[model samples]
Each structure stands twice: as C-alpha cells, then as structure tokens.
Target chain A: MKSWLTTTDHKRIALLYLGTMTLFFTLGGLVATVIRVELATAASDLVTADTYNRLFTLHGVIMVFFFLIPSIPTFLGNYLLPLMLGAPDLAFPRLNLASWYVFVAGGLLTLTAMVAGGLDTGWTFYTPYSTTFSDSHVILAVLGVFLAGLSSVFTGINFIVTTHRLRAPGLAWLRLPLFVWSLYATSLILVLATPVLAMTLLLVAIERGLHVGIFDPEAGGSPLLFQHFFWFYSHPAVYIMILPGMGVISELVPCFSRNRPFGYGFVAASSLAIAVFGFLVWGHHMFVAGQSYFASVVFSFLSFAVAVPSGVKVFSWLGTMHRGSIWLTTPMIYALGFIALFTIGGGTGLALAMLAVDVHLHDTYFVVAHFHTIMVGGMLMAYLGGLHFWWPKISGRLYSERWGRIAAYTLFIGFLLTFLPQFVLGTQGLPRRTASYPPEFQFLQGLSSAGATILAVGYVLPGVYLLASLVRGRPAGDNPWGATGLEWCTSSPPPPHNFVRPPVVTDDPYDYPRAPQPTITGVGDA
Target chain B: MPEAVREPFADPAHQRDAVALGMWAFLGQEVLFFGVLFVFYTSLRVRHPELFAAFAPRLDWRLATVMTVALLISSFTMALAVRFAFTRARRSLVLALSTTMILGAAFLALKGWEYAHHFEHGETPQIDLAGLGRGPGLATFFGVYFVLTGFHALHVLGGLGALGWLAVAAWRTPASDLRGSPVMAVGLYWHFVDIVWLFLFPALYLAGRLAP
Candidate 1:
C-alpha cells in the first residue's frame, strides 16, 4: 500500500486502479445479487421498497461510474499507452499518479456515503427528487461522482497528448495501431463530455444546499433542461465506456485470426465517428421524457447517422475473418461474442430511436436489457478478452487456457439468459426498478434471477483462475502470440523504461506473414 | 547522414513545439468545459430574458469591472514575463510573473467581497427575492448567474493557488531550461481564464439594455 502511494510509475498506477476497481466491482455485484434476490420472490419480501431503491441505485452507481467507465481505460490504457506510443512514460507522470489518488478519494467518499445510509438518487441524480426528495447522502455521493469526472478528464488529457507527441521515430500516424486510435477517440470524448457532467452535478449540489433554481420547474427552470445537460455528457459517456473495449476487440480478432485487420483506415475512422455522433444522440434518450419535438427529430437522425460507422466496423471485422485461418482461442471466442452482442445492443438502440417504439420501451426492462447487452455483453466481454490476450504481455505469466475458455463460454451463455427475458418482460409492459411486480411477469423474472446466478458464476471463474495463475502459471516470453506491435518487442513484463533500446518501426503494424515464425520471443535490443 | 550535422537547435525547438501544440489541445478542452456553462446560461437567458436582466443589476458591476481590469493587467504582465524569460532575462521575468500572481489573488479577494455583499443584501436567488420580483423567470435568472459566476470564481481561486506554487518554484529552482516554458504554459491557462470572465462580465453584469 505504501509503495502504491509513493510510486510514480504508470504500471503501478494501473495496479492501484486494478486493486481498487476490483473491490468496487465485487461490492457492486453484491448489490446486484440483492436486487435479483428481492425480485425473485415476486413480492417485496426480502427488502422494503426504499431499500430496494437504494440497492438498485448503488448498483447503477457502482457499476456505471466505478466499474464500467474505468474498466478498460484506467487499467489497460494506463498500462499499455506509453508502451504503444513508444514513450518512457505517459507525458505527465505526476498528473497520471494524481488521477489515481483522485480516483481513490472519490471511491472512499462514495463508500462513506453508502455506509452512512446510502444515496438513493441512482447514478443520474435527476433533479427535484435529488434536490428535495432523497433521504440519503445525496451531496456526498454527487461529490464523489464530481471527483471521478475530474479524474477522468485528467486521464483524457494525458492520453491525448501522449499519443500526439510521443510516437517512436518511425512509428508515423498511419502506422499507429487501432487500439491507440480508439483510446485517442475515447480520450477526446472523455475530455469533452465529462466536464458537462461535472457542472450538471455541481448544479444539483448547489440546488440541494443553497436553494439554487437550475432544474426546479417551480422556479421556472425546466427539468427537461437538466435531462438535456445530463444526457449530453452521458450519452457520449457510453461511447467512452465502450470505445476502448471495441479497440481491444479490434486488436484481438486480427491477431488470433492470423490476418491483418481488413480496412484498417475504416476501423480507425469509425472510432472518431462514434465519438462525434455520440454527442448528437443524447436527446434520443429523452424522446419519451418530453424533449422538444425538433430536438427529438435531430437526435433521431443523429442516432441513425451514428449507426453507419458502427455497422462499418462490424462488416470490417467480418471481412477480416472471411478468408483468415481463424483460431478459436479464448480471446477470439470472446471477440466473436462481442461482435454478436454489440450488434444486438446496437440494433436495439436503433429500435429505441423510433420515438413511437421508445414511448412504449422507456423505463421498461427492454431499455435495461439493451444497455446491459452493450455494456456487459459487449464491453465486459471485450475487456475480459483483452485481459486474457494481454495477460502474457502485462504479467509475464500465463493464465490457464482451459478455465479461460470455460469462463468465456459461460459468460456468453449467462449474459444471454440474464437479459433475453428482460426484453420479453419489457415488451409486455413491465417497468424497471420496481421492488414488486404483478404476477403476470413472474415467469420472466424467475428466468432472469436464475440467469443472474449463472452470470455470477461466470464472473467469478476468471477471478479464481487469474489469481491462481499469478502464483503458479508458466512464464510468458515476449511476443507469445506472435503479434506485431512495439509492445511485443520488449520483455513480457517490460522494464522501468519500457524498452532497453528504442524500436524503429519499418513495416505496417500486425504484418504477420512477413514476420518471423514462433513470434520474436525476446526483446530486440534489450 | 552525419549525426553531428543534425542541427543542434532543431531538436529542442521541435520538443517545445510539441509541448505548445499539446497545451493548446488541452486549452481546447478547457473551452468546452467553460462552454458547457455558457451554453446553459444562453439557453436559460432565451427562456427568460427579462428576469435575467432584472437579476443582472444586482450583481455588483463595480466588482466585476475591477476584476476584469486586474485580469487584463495580469495578462500583460504574463506576456512580458514570458517574453523576458524566453529571452533569458531571469530576474525581471520572475518579478513580472509574481506581479501576475498577486493581481490574480486580488481579483479573487474582490470576488469574495462581492459574494458577501450579495449574501448580506438577501439578493441570493432563492433567499431574498420578494422585493426583487415574483416571477419564476427571475428565479431562473438568479440560478444561472450563481452557477456561472460561482463556477468561474472557483476556477479563479484554483488558478491563484497554482500560480502561487509556480511562483515559489520559480524563486527556488535555477532559472534554467523548462523554467520559462512552464511559466509560459501556465500563463496561457491564466489568460484563458480571464478570457472566460471577459465574456462573463458583459453576459452577467452588463446583460440588460441599460442607459450607457
């Protein structure tokens, strides 16, 4: 803990995030278990209505802000960015460490708020209710969220500059890897979208503390305006959550498929397109919530526009796999799962964009299912896949392939079982966040609860094997996968400077056939 | 390709250029940060123009005007400091940089006084508005003012604290390489903050169609 406190190293900072985020993920999953358990009985027998509210709120807050948002970016991006960019460290090493401290401070404050009676405003902290109605520690929780947003901004700034200024001598812009491009796009959104969230929360805090009238309808302020500002940041924020994961999938698929990514330029630009279009589609989330009619039209068209680039990516991945010698390794399996699940998530999003349909689906379990598909099935799957793919590079050891394959399959199946019935329940008009529901929806709820148990098992498998492997696994030599990147040119666990001698790139990244077989197993000039 | 003939000055110049371009990119994010608040203020003003005007007079224009000038003068000193320090005039440059920091502190002190004055007069948006007006639009105006000005004030105070630390470092560290660069970079941020207030002054304090 003391070493973690004093370390200026980026890898150590990633470890700090890894330890802290893993704890938050477990706590968040615990709350989710309570939620499923409560709903399993069909009556509010396990907890009261208010307790149920707090449970779901804590689940969303912990999962969205703590788990999903930072899952890929903080842990993986922090470890890999400098290495990929061929820099000694991130451009601002002290600022990088400062971000981790800020993350910990925010996490501590949130835990304090939870223990001191818990915040019931959900992660959104919507006005009027958040300002006047909630009984729990709203201000403290919102303050934690504000700190986290600032931390995200600092990280965004670091990644953007590092990518721009620190590329190796011959690693020109066009030669850069897709994962780096994805982080660059995600960083752009993080820098732009996060600050609006900060100010929106600040307004909420001020309104709660000092009778400010920002979102008070009684005070002639529009509640819809609050929705606008909140979603403006948050809608793009979903891209922030998923873009890095998509990046991981992009890297993993081509490497295991034994082919270069088809249309690298297309995949790279899609990331930026998603980032820009994401900002325009926030009002689609507000379609049923009384946003202006013109705003709704604009959002719908922009949402449709956003789908094109995403579709291009899906096609490009499929194109990459068409004639390639596909290896069904665990990471590749998860990548396949991501393409399928993210498609479903993306398609459902398109369905919700149609205002008439969304009017029926809003606040229903369908919306819940759509996001979980993207966030859990897509983002979490990609993150786990990248974790497996890069574990060799990161830890200099091998996790068990047998357990990894089993866990990946289990997670895929479990995710489907958990979310598929929610679509049915939502279509049949069952609302989300209810402690008790009518008996007509009982069967679907039961299936979901059973599925939740299965998903929990899947989630826990990696934790068990990954930890065990750390102690007992075989050492992974550099470039275990035979992938072509500057990172693989170094030791499996890189040294303090990341490289012994600076690599000068002369070929396209991921050029497999021209590369030597059995994967350049040692550092080039180390 | 003789390594010795690779232009002795070009490498450092390139590094500085990279740093400058990266800093501008960062400043672009800062614009969006303050821009979000400005967007909110603009939309709210459109919703209730009269009420915005009614609350505009209550904001002490005198304080706003003074802070504006202090910030402008600080910008001048910051420019001179960067200009001098870059030319390797270490001593005069440090004094000019410290002058900018002092001016920034004074700006914040005046803002604190203005906030106190508003509090005492019961002119805060929700607290004491009976005599001011009864419309909900008026309440919305005060809310926008508080959010924008209050956020701006926080940035001012933060900038002053950072500038203070930079000043201490300037005095202690030898006025060597990266010295002028750090100050110049910080000056860019400070000037940007002032530019935000330049827009804010007319928007908040002089918003209404008053007799000039």
Candidate 2:
C-alpha cells in the first residue's frame, strides 16, 4: 500500500486518480439524491433553504471540480498517454505523483469547509454574493478550488510535454489516434484557462478577506468583470470536462463500428476548433447578467459558430457507423447514447445562445436541464463507455458483458427520465436554485426524483460488477477488444515500464487489419 | 552525463531537449496566468483612467525601478549560470546561481519594503489613500496592486528556492550531470518569473503616471 502511495509509475498514478475520483463521484451523487428528494415535494420539507443551497452547491462543486474535470484525462489519459505515444512514462514522473497528492489535499480542504460550515454560493461563485453577501466558508472553498486548479496545471504541463516530445518515430501527426488529439487539445485549454480561474478565485478570496471593493458594487467594482474572468476560464472549462469524453468516444466509436472515423482530419481538427472557439463564447453566459447588447450579439454568434465543429464531430461519428460491422456492445451503447444526448444538449445550448431565448431561459431550469444533458448524459455516458472499453487493457480482466449492457441501457433510460422533465419544468418558467416550486410543477419534479433513484442504481451496478471482475473475471489477453493502438501492442496490465521493449510504430493508428504489429525493440536494444 | 539521460530517452541530448520543451510549455501557461491579470488591469484602467492616475502617484517608482534592476540582473545571472552549466564549469555555475539568488532576494526585500510603506500610509486594499476618497475605484486600484504584486512575489520566492537547489546540486554533483537539463529548466522558470515582472513593473508603476 505504501508502495502504491509513493510509486511514480504513470499507471499507478492513474489508478490513484481513478479511486479518488470515484469516491468524489459517489459523494456528489449522494448529494444530488438529497437534492432530488427535497424537490420531490412542493415545499422545503426535506431540508431548510440553507441546507438545500449548500447541498446543491456542494453537488456542483464536487461533480465539476473533483469528478468530471479529472474523470477521463487524469485517469485514462495518464494511463494511456504513454502507452499510446509509445513512451515509457510521462516527462516528469515524480511530478505526476505530486499532482495526485495535491489533488487529494485540495479535496480534503474543501471537505473541511463542508464540515466546518457550508459554502452557499453556487459553484459559479458569482461575485458580490460570494464576495460580500454570503456568510459561509467561502474562503476555504475558493482556496480548495484554487489548489485543484494547480493540480490541473501540472497535469496539463505533463500531457503537453509528453505529447510533443515523446511520440514514437513513425507515429506522425496524422497517424496519431483521435484520443491523443483530443487530449492534446484538452490540455491546451487546461493549461491556458485554469490559471485565470485560479487568479479570479484569489481575487474573490482577497475581496472577502480584506473587505476590498474588487467585486462588490458599493466599491465601484464591476461585477461583470468577475463574470468575464470567471467565464473566461470556466467556459473553456466546460470543454475541459467534455473534450476528453469526446476523445474517449473517438476511440470507442471506431473500435465498435469496425471502421475508422469517417473524416479523421476533420474529427481531430474539431477538438482544437472546440477548444479555440470555446474561449470566445463565454460572454453568452453573461448576456442576461447585464453585459452590453452588442457583446451579447457577438457572443451569441460565436456560440452558434462553435456548434459547427461539434456538429462536425457528431456527423463524423455517424459516418463511421455507416456500412460498418457495428457491434452493439456496452461501450457502443453508451457511445450511441452520448451522440443522441449530446446533440440534444448542444441543440438546447444553441437556443440558450440566442439572445432572445436566453433572456427567457436564463436562470431557469432550462439552463440546468441543458447542461445536465451535456455533462451527465453526454460526458458521463462517454466516461462509462471508455471505462468499459478499456477495462481489459487496464485490469487485464473481463467484466460481465451482459451486466455491462444492462447498466448502460438502464443508465440511458434513467438519465432521460431524470433530465427530460426538467426541460418541461424549465419551459414552464420554473426558476433554478429554488427550494420550493408551485404545486403544478411537483408532478414533473417527482418524476425527476424517481428517475434519480433509478439512475443511482444504474451507477452502482457497474461499481459492483467491475470490482467483482477484478477478482473472478476471466484473464483478458493484451488486446481484448481487438482495438488498434500502441496500447494494445503490449501485454495486459502492462509492465512497470509499460513496454517490455521500446515499441517502434510502423503503421498508421486504428488500422484494423492491414497495420503491422509494432516492432518491440528489446530492452537495451534501442 | 549518463545519469542525466533518465529512462525513456535514449540519449542525454534528447533528455535535455525534452526537459527544455516541457519547461517552455509550462512557461506558456505561465504567460496566460499573468495575461489574465493584465487583461483585468487594463480593463479597469480603461474604465477609470482618472482614478488609476490618482493611485499611480502613490507608488514610489524609484523603489520599483531599483527592484526592476535587481530582477533584470537576476535574469542575467540565471542566464550566465545556464551558460556555465554548458561548459561544465562547476565553480562558475555555483557562483552565477548564488548571485541570481541574492539579486532575487534583493528584489523581494525592496518589494517587502514597498508593501510596508503602503501599509504605514494606510494605502491598503481595504483603505483608501490619505487624500484620495474612500471610493471603490481607489480601493480597487490598490486591490489590483496588492494582488498582482503579491502573486508575482510568490513566484519570485519559488524561483529563489529553485535557484538555491540548483546551486547546491552544482556544487556537489560530478561534472557530467551538472552540465545538463536541470540547470536549463530552472533557468527557463527564472526567466519567466522575470518576464512577468517586466510586464508588472510598467503596468503597475509606470502606467497613468502624469508626465513630470
């Protein structure tokens, strides 16, 4: 256990992140369950307004900062990046372990805030409210988030350096897997955007601590400035959450469909496109918060424009599926679900981007429903699919395929039942962050709550079966899924150095039949 | 030199190149980190030119100039240390690194003095200057001032630690690995911290100063 704790192996660090993030995911899920139960009724009987606020805030904070952002990139990316790139390990191995410890430290600090008192500011931590109005543990929470941002910075630096400096000799840029491309793009955003968030949070800390007027209105500071800085980081941060999931699907879709992505160049380019354009559309979030009309119009246009790249990706996936040996495996099921749900999420996002529509939907449950589809429906499905797809490669064991499919389908159904009604409630003018709603909205709210229970089951089933598989499941060979990547060119649960010998790539990535097995130059033979 | 080539890389040169590239990538992120603050400071200045002008006089540009020179000299000494590492000149490398640390400490000392003076005059983020009204704008100017410089000072402190570590390693290690990637990596970071100050010095101290 101490060896596992101190190991600098990228694979071990990946497992550490996996175990830690899963704990945070479960905690976030439990908080959401409480929120659903409280909203099940028409009144605030389940918890007080204050507790509800804390519950939801904690839910958002944990899910976004601790779970989704670190979900794919930190775990899967850390494990698979070196394998995919044919490198022994990340550029800075010890620093990689340090990042994990830093992440845990940040998590502990935030948890301490929850224990001491709860932060009531929403996860966005909008200014004036976070800076002046709230009387909770805002400072500790902000500090926690700042530290988490530091961890992200380290991860980003590791990835960018590893990718740029460590690719195998023959793995040219075009031949790189779409997952690597997506990760590289995601790292760019992580490196550039997270610091702005760190600084903005620091400003919030200073404002709160010093009673300075940096964000408070009475001090002539523009609250809009806070939004600008926060969204500058956070708007791109949404990509940080989903772009890696896109990377996961990029791998899963081709492998399950038995074909390469339809437009490989377009698919790879779209990730970069999304990252670049993601930064430009942050003002759309501030349109209803009193930004200039012209700025809103510009942001609205950019928001719509950014959808084109995502649409390209969605079409590329469908095109990959056309006329192929499509296998409806568990991972494939989740990939299909991601495509459908992310489309709905992206479409609703367009509506929200429209200046007029956003005026109506801003601060409404519609926004909540839209993002949940993207985050939970879109990103989480892809996360589960990637986990299932790579399970053999990671653990060298096979989970029950039958159970995996059941969980995937159940999660899709439960997710739809959960969030679909929120769209209706939102369209009917139910504002978000409210503890109580009118009696009429209770039916849909109750339905959403019931769906949450099912969703919880769907989530728990995989944890049980996956853990069971570790001990009792069949031993998987190196390439269980018959996928094409450098990662499959080695033994299962690969050796400490990953490759027994350095892998020399001789063919393009994802070449199902024609690609040659990578030549392993034996140790000291390079 | 053999130890300098860590696993994964086949040769010492490759390891050096990779480490240098990694440091450059990290520096890119550092640019954006300070870039956001510059954006915020610029927007605020554009919004209230008169208030920033009023607050600009409160900063002692002479002390800031001294600190700027100290930082510039530190960057030069850091470059010299990296150059000496290439030549495997252990004594020169150690001398250059220690010089960089001393200059860095000097800059920090001057910054500490400036912060102390501000506190003595009640020119804090919480309080307005003596003659300047307790307007949010004035408070915001000082708020931005303290936060920007405070964060930069933290970076300098971090750089000093790195320089000190490199100095000790240079003094103790065999000549081969001493002239390798570690010296260059730390040099890149020190240079980056110096660059951030170059921006901060002009943006904070010189901007909006009335001529003569």
Candidate 3:
C-alpha cells in the first residue's frame, strides 16, 4: 500500500487512475440511472424538478470532467505509452503520478460541490447563469475543473515529450504504433486547448466568488464570449475524449483482423487533422444561443469540415477489416459496435451541424442522443474495448471470454435502445435537462429508462469478472493475443521499471502475420 | 551531490534536451493561458474605447515601469543562472538565482502598492459593475486589468517558489555534478513571466492612451 502511494512507476499510476476513474464512472453512471428513472414518467415521479436538474448536472460533471476526459489518456495511456515506446517509463513518472493525484483532488472537490447544494448550470457552466446568477456551488465546481485542466496539461506534456524523445533507437516516427499516433494527436489538443478551459474556469471562479463576474451582461460582458472560450477547449476536448479511443480501435482492428491497416497513414494523419480542425468549430454550439448569423454560418461549415477526418478514420477501419481474418472476440464486438454507433453518432452530429437542422434540434433530446451516440457510443465503447483488449496485459490475468462477449452485446443493445428514441423525441420537441415532460413523450421515456438499467448491468458485469480474474483467473503470459506492440514483448502486468531489458523496436507496429511467435489466444488456456 | 543524470535517458545531454523541449511546450501552454485574457481585453477595449482611455492613465505608469524593470532584470539573472548551471559554477548559479528571486519578490511588492493606490481611487477587488450599463464602463476596463495582472502575479508567485528551491539546490550541490535541466526549465519559465509582463506592460500601461 505504501509502495502504491509513493511509487512513480507508470504501471502503478495507471492502476491508480483506473481505480479512481472506475469509481467516478460508477458514480456518474448511478447519477445517470436516477436521471433516466425520473425521466421515465411525464411527471417528476422519482425526484423533484430541482433535484432532477441537480442529478443530470452531477451526471454530466462527473462523467465528462472526471471520467471521460481522463478515461483513456490517464488510465490506459499512462500504462501503455512507455511500454509501446520501448522506454522504461514515461518522460516524467513523478509528474505522471502528480497528474493522478491532482485529478483525484479535483474529483473530490467537485463531489463536495455536488454534496453541498449542487449547481444546476449543467457541466457547460454557461456564464451569466454560472458566474453572475445561479447561487449553486459554481466556485467549487469551477475550481475543480481548473485543477483537472492543469493535470491534463501536465499529462499531455509528459506524453508529447515521452513519445518524441523516448522512442527506442529503431522506433522511428513511421514505425510508431497507431495508438501512439492517436495519443500524440490527443496530447496536442490536451496541451494546447486545456489551458483555454483553465482560463475560462478561472474567470468563472473569480466572478462567482467575488461578485465581479466577467460574463455579467450588466457589465458589458458578452455571454457569447464566455461560450466561445468554454467551447474552444471543450470541443477539442470532445476530440480528446474520442481520439484515444480511435487509437485503441486502431490497435484492436488490425490485431483481430489479422491484417495491417489498409490506410494506416491516412488513419494516423486523421487524428492530427481532427485535433486541428476541432479548434475551429466551437461556435456551432452557439449558433442558436444569440450568435450572429454570419458567425454561425462559418461555425456550421467548420463543424462539417471537422467531420471529414473522423469519417476518414471510420472508413479506414472498415477498409482494414474488409477481407481480413475477422474474429468476433469481445473487444472486436465493441469495436464493431463503436463503428456502427459512432457512424450514427457522427452522422447525427453532422445533422446537428446544419444551420437549419440545429435550430430544430438544439438542446433537445436529439442533441443529447447525438452526442451520447458519439461519447457513450463512440468514446465509451472504444474505452471498454481497449480495457478488455488490454485487460490481460494490465492485470496479468485472463478474463472469461464468454462473459466478456455477454457484456459487449448487452451494452451495444442497451446503448442503442437508450439513445435512439431520444433522437426521435428530440425531433418531436422534448427539451433536455428536465424531469417533467409532456405526457406524449412518456412511452419513449420509459423505454429509455429501461435501457439505462440494461446498460448499467452491461457496465457492471465486467467489474465483477475482471476483479475475480485478478485472483483466480489464469496467468496471462507475455504477448497474450499474439499482438505486435513493444508492450507485448514485456511481462504481463510488467516489471517495476516496465521492461527487464529495454526493448528496441525492430519490427513494424501491428506487424501481425509476420510476428513469428505462435499465437496464444488467452482464450481456452484455462 | 545531486545526480548529474536521471532515469529513462541515455545520458545527461539527452535529458537536458528533453527537459528543455518540455519547458518550451509548457511555455506554449502558458501563452494560450495569457492569450485568452489578452483576447478578452482587446474585445472589451475595442467596444468601450473612451472608458479604457479614461481608465488606462489611472494606473501609475511610473510604478509599473519600476515593476517592469525589476522583472526584466530578474529574467536576465535567471538566464545567467541557467548558463551557470551548464558551466557548473555553483556559486555564480546561486548568486544569479537569488538575485532573480529577490527581483521577482520586489516586483510583487510594487504591484501590491499599485493595487493599494488603485484601491484608494475605488479600484477595489470587486468590480463596480454599475459602470458597465450606465456609466463610464471604467469598472469593465479595471476588471480586465485586474484579472490579467492578477493571473500574472500568481504565476510569478509560483515562479518564486520554484526559484527559491533552485537557490537552495544550487547551494547544496557540487558544481561539477549539478544538473542544468531543472535550472534551465525554471529559467525558461522565469523568462516567460518576464515576456508576459512585457505584453502586460504595454497592454495595461500604454496601449489604451487616447490619441492626443
């Protein structure tokens, strides 16, 4: 326990983040359940309207800030970045450890805010409402986000330096794994975009605390300016959440397909493209929020432009799996689910990007469905896939393949059931962030709530078996799944310093079919 | 003696380069940090020019000049400290770092006095928001000024803590085995704070002067 607390080992830090994020995700998920339960009926059956507002706010705050943003980057990236690069550890292990502690500090503070008369400002923390008006714990919540943003910047800088400077002698840029490329792209956004959020949140805190609000309209402050700054970091933050998941999907696709990615370079380049283009489209969120027509047009166009790279990735993954030895393993199922769900998610996003369409869908259940399709459907699915894919390597144990399959299918179905109707409900005109709805929407609302329960079950199933695997499951030997990254060359759960001997990358990443080692499926080995 | 080399690097030189590169990246992050405030200031100034013109001269520029010079000298001393780190001049490194720390502290002291002066003129911490709607919008200008400089002050305070640690570390370490990366990184940050003030100096102290 002491070693766990004091250790600078990247692997240990990864576990620390994993444990913390899981707790937050579960908390966030629980909040989500109550939200869905309340939404099931037209009347506020489960909670008061005020309580309902607070519940969704807590869900969004916990999920977005605490879990999704840090989900892959801190948890999976921390553990695997060094191992993939053939380095002993991240560029700054101590800073990496510091990032986790800072994140937890932020999480705990936000929880305190939640407990102390939680804000109904939504996670966006839109100003005037957030800074000058709403009397909820905006100061604490904004400070919590500020600290998390700082941790993100540090984590991003660590990855950027480590990937650039610490790659083994032969691990040239082109030889880099897709996951590394995805993380590198993700870090660019992390380092650059996060501070903008920090500044916005800082201003929010100052205003909220001192009654000297920057976004106060009575003070000549444009609330639109606040939205501009908030989304500048946040929209890129959306990509930050998903790009790493794309990276994981990149790894899982080729590994399961038994084929090299058909458009590896394009897919790699798309991550960078998405990061760059993401910064330009923050205005789309403001089109109907009193923004000018000309600016909204430009923002809407840019939003569509950003989707091109995302589409490039989707097609590239499909092409990679076109004729290869396709395995319906648990991870692959989630990857497949990701592609299907994210396609709908991304497609709906484009719909929302249209100037006219967004006027109809803005702040409706459709918007909720659209992003959940991307975030929950795309990012969360990819996270689960990566977790299952790397579980053996992370824990040095093999989970039940049968059970893993069960959870993936259940999750995919539950996700679709929960979100699909919301898109229709949105078009039919049900606004989001409320408990009471018109009686007409109740049928779909009930269906959505039922789906959330199944989704909860889907999420929890893995926890039970994954924990069990740590003690009783078969030991995962080096290179389970017969993968080709440098990480697979090291021991399962890795050593204290990661590798017993530093690995030099002599083969290409995902160099399957050519990875001469016999495949050990980790399946049926027990 | 502090170790000359750290882990995950082949040698001290590689370690030095990585640390330098990391600091540059962080500086890029900081630029965006200050960049947002500059943006806010520019838009607000453009919207309410006379209010800014009226408010800009309210700050005692002479005091700001003193603060600016103090920060500039600290940055210069910080550079020397970094240079001395590479040269393994422990005594010189300590001298330069201490000088930098003192200058940074002095700048903060002058800033405090300036804030006090502004307070005497009713530029208290809370913005007099009534000015935004019906009056000179002087509060808005002052609000931007306070936030911009306030964040910079926080950065300098954080820098002082770092610089003080570097001074102690330099005093304890054998010159021959001194690692320059940490010193160089801190130096870069100190210089960055100075550069921000260079921008802040003009933006706050000069930019809003009305034509004639």
Which number leads on lDDT?
A: 2
For candidate 1, what is the lDDT? 0.83
Instruction: List all candidate RMSDs to the true structure.
Output: 4.2, 4.2, 1.8
TM-score for candidate 2, please give it: 0.96
Q: Which tens-of-lDDT digit does each residue in B106-187 have in candidate 3?
A: 9999898888888788875466645446533667777888999999999999999999888898888777778888998998
Point out the higher-scoring one by DockQ: 2 or 3: 3
The DockQ of predicted model 1 stands at 0.36
State in Å the error of residue B156, model 1: 1.8
- Tens-digit lDDT string for candidate 2 (B1-212): 21456776778788788889888878887888888778777777877777677888889888899898998998899999989998988898889999999999999998998899898887887843253344566567887898789989999999999888888878788776665588898999998898889888888898787544
Q: What are the per-model DockQ values?
A: 0.36, 0.52, 0.61
Residues A1-526, model 2: lDDT tens digits? 9999999999999999999999999999999999999999999998999998999999999999999898899999999999999999998898799999999999999999988988999999998899878989999999999889999999998999889889988879898899999999999999899988998898898888877677666665778899999999999999999999998998988887778789999999999999999989999999888888899899999999999999999999999989877878788999999999999999999999999888888898999999999999999999999999889889998888889889999999999999999999888889999898899999999999999998999999999999999999888788766678989889989999998888887877777545343232221110
Candidate No. with top DockQ:
3
True interface contacts reproduced, per candidate: 0.39, 0.62, 0.55
Instruction: State the DockQ, from 0 to 1, for candidate 3.
Output: 0.61
Error of 1 at A13 (Å): 1.4
Ranked candidates, highest lDDT first: 2, 3, 1
By TM-score, who's the top model here?
3
In model 2, the clashing pairs are A219-B136
Checking candidate 3 for backbone clashes, the offending pairs are: none
> What's model 1's TM-score?
0.95
Off by over 4 Å in 3: A516-526, B128-136
